[model samples]
Target: MEWLQPTSENLIEGYDEPQGKLDIDRVESKQITTNTIISDFFVMLNCLGERTVSQLPAPDDKVYHRIMEEIAPYFERILIIKINNQIIEVSLQHVKKEALTILNNKAVHPVLDEFFHGEADKSGYNLFGQVPNRSVYKVLPHFIDPLEDPEVQQLFDFLKEMCSVTKDFGFILKPWLLSDELKQLQAIRFAAHYCQDVYLWVDNDTERIFEIQFKF
Candidate 1:
């Protein structure tokens, strides 16, 4: 283990101890595993709010599973992390792409491009309803729970500020009732509507927001 410690710096130079077998293949394997875990963490951070098992190279890896288990409880539906003086707008695939585009052009903003995935269904729950009559719909209260995370909360605050300072960044704050039919209970719903600028909205009837499609 002592010899392994120095390899963390890429300077492998100890073989006196019996435990130090100095197996190059084993060292490379461990390095790859460690890199994979790190890359997966960053990918999760880049995903904003949508995460699927498909994103991982080895979704079945116990170490990866353990890492996700430890951090999943604190995961937000969106990834909002500060980078230097500017915040990185990496979330939904499109928003992340647009952010990359802007970065390519060397431009930035207080708010990332607005992206929301919501649409209507036959069930009569108008999520980001296209029909004029069903413009508004219900939202689950717990959906807002992710905002409690400090970075996400900071992004929300920055977004609110952007709304106040600029006309291009617009959002509608709505309140509705969230009901759990199975649990026979309901709660208050409060969330901002940012998808309109991007031509989408969130549906309220579905508890699984990620499953819904966003209007392109």
Candidate 2:
């Protein structure tokens, strides 16, 4: 199926408006696919006040079973918080873990693997230059230096561009890692691309407030 744009109108279509309101600003649908659609739907459910967990209506195939088994643990860690008269809940760690597991353990498509490594040191900095191993070096020096050398600047620009491309195309390449039966392994090549640390505020009565803070 073609990807669908995630809009406020689409989010509220089937749900009762009186139950909750959607903070659409937090919603983003960059790489669209059935996998992304299912993932995003769950994200929206957590964003709303839906406490129950629902399984994806996937066919009884190896791909479906593998995906479910991989994500099951994360579902167990889901936490729910009520804030400002609204309940907010989300469990993305499982998704990230699953994605990373798939990427690291399975052999990636040659094209996608090339894309990942080619852009690994795009910034031209030596941060990842010393290591010949793409996987190891690609994630090293997560932070960029401010020394401002010409070579370093070039590499940094490359890294930024590569990050953008991955965000745009990663979803398309994910299905390739699935078994022939259409079961996809959990791969997290896109994990670092969307990293954000969350903080919460709790009162004496255990009431909680959800907040997001970014790390440099």
Candidate 3:
């Protein structure tokens, strides 16, 4: 084992020791097994969409049972991580589509378009209710501006009502702000009063205040 450590002088020459033999067949089998496990886990997650507290398949289910048993408690954690990644990807796509629609109808700043099209943070929670919190909302600068016009005020009021209704059930909101001024104000206001911790950012390109909500 000590001889396997390559020194700087011999590093470029490669290992001096003879190549150790490996069981290629066994390695291939393990690789296949790992792929199968991951594939099955994804399938399970897809089946669990929108439904809370899914019942695991019986231990007699062979393939699924074997995978879960092998992974044990870590299986749930991996499943959740994969699910969250999938949700974030889907949620971002949904947001881009909606933003594009909004842009087509109204003249929006180029910077705002770019900001919306670019990467967004994936940080929110799922709230349960009749409407359900499928969309993630980001509190934009317009949301907290005290001098907002009537139209802007109405939009904020609508958002506040939505937030209030979903407070008990819980919802996810991200804040993409152009300054810390609005972000700090909104965070304390929304979180303390409505129990929402909206994600915040400072970007001049960001225009609308909204959230990225997702399903499943």
Candidate 4:
């Protein structure tokens, strides 16, 4: 089926915390009355969220692309349905489409993928749930002198671009996460079973999130 933009951006917004307001079971129940395909997609997302807790190694590019392609159409379709029903503002379409493009078009650069080295250490918390807190400083500690290495500089540039894009939206990218210098940053901090100190910093916050693993 063709991908329709989602009715609610919050439902399928990328790199966001799980919705507290949204009781997935309830939403599923209600949505099933209207569209089984959308309800099924919600179920899939919920399952994916649960599976995310395993702290698995990042999927290979091909695997990642396959997953995105498989899901993108559903997200788009859901958004379109929502808009048609007058459930949300029309402005949300741009945001949702941007997300869809990221999923469908963007591939994790080899350098960025190598940042994990292995199982991503799985040691930090932020808006994207328990996924890797992929700060360049944490991931590529060796490139302390980034300017000295052209390759590292290139990677930094890519990260900065990524940071700018994510920051423009309501999400925080690892590279642009709350930094000490960006004191104006607002963040959500909480404790999790695996990590004691977790922070969720959102858009336009000029702060950096320091990985707790390093302090210890």
User: On TM-score, who's better, 2 or 4?
Assistant: 4
lDDT of 3 by residue, 17-84 (tens): 22343221101112122222223222322222234332222212343344343322222222311222
Candidate 1: misplaced stretches above 4 Å?
Answer: 1-129, 135-147, 165-216
Number of the candidate with higher TM-score, 3 or 4 = 3
Candidate lDDT scores, in order, read 0.26, 0.27, 0.28, 0.26
Q: Cα deviation of 190 in candidate 2 (Å)?
A: 19
lDDT accuracy of residue 111 in candidate 3: 25
**Runs in model 4 with CA error above 4 Å?**
1-48, 51-71, 74-107, 110-120, 124-167, 172-216
lDDT for residue 67 in candidate 3, whole number 0-100:
36
lDDT of 1 by residue, 41-105 (tens): 33333443333222211112443343334322222333322333233222212123433343446
lDDT of 4 by residue, 1-216 (tens): 011111212222344422333211101101112222222222232232222211111123442232233333333222211212222111111113333344345453333322221132243434354433232222222211122434434433322332232322112233333333222221111011112212232233323332222110
Candidate 2 residue-wise lDDT, 1-216, digit = tens? 011111222111232222444431122212222232223323332322224343232222442333343333334343322334443322232233443443456554432342233332233333212323211012111332212234323322322333331212111111111112111111122222233211111121212111111111
Q: Which stretches of candidate 2 lie over 4 Å from their true place?
A: 1-67, 70-90, 94-102, 111-216
Report the Cα lDDT for candidate 1: 0.26
34 in model 1: Cα distance from truth in Å?
A: 23
Candidate 3 regions off by >4 Å?
1-102, 108-145, 168-216
Worst 10 residues of 3 by lDDT: 87-96
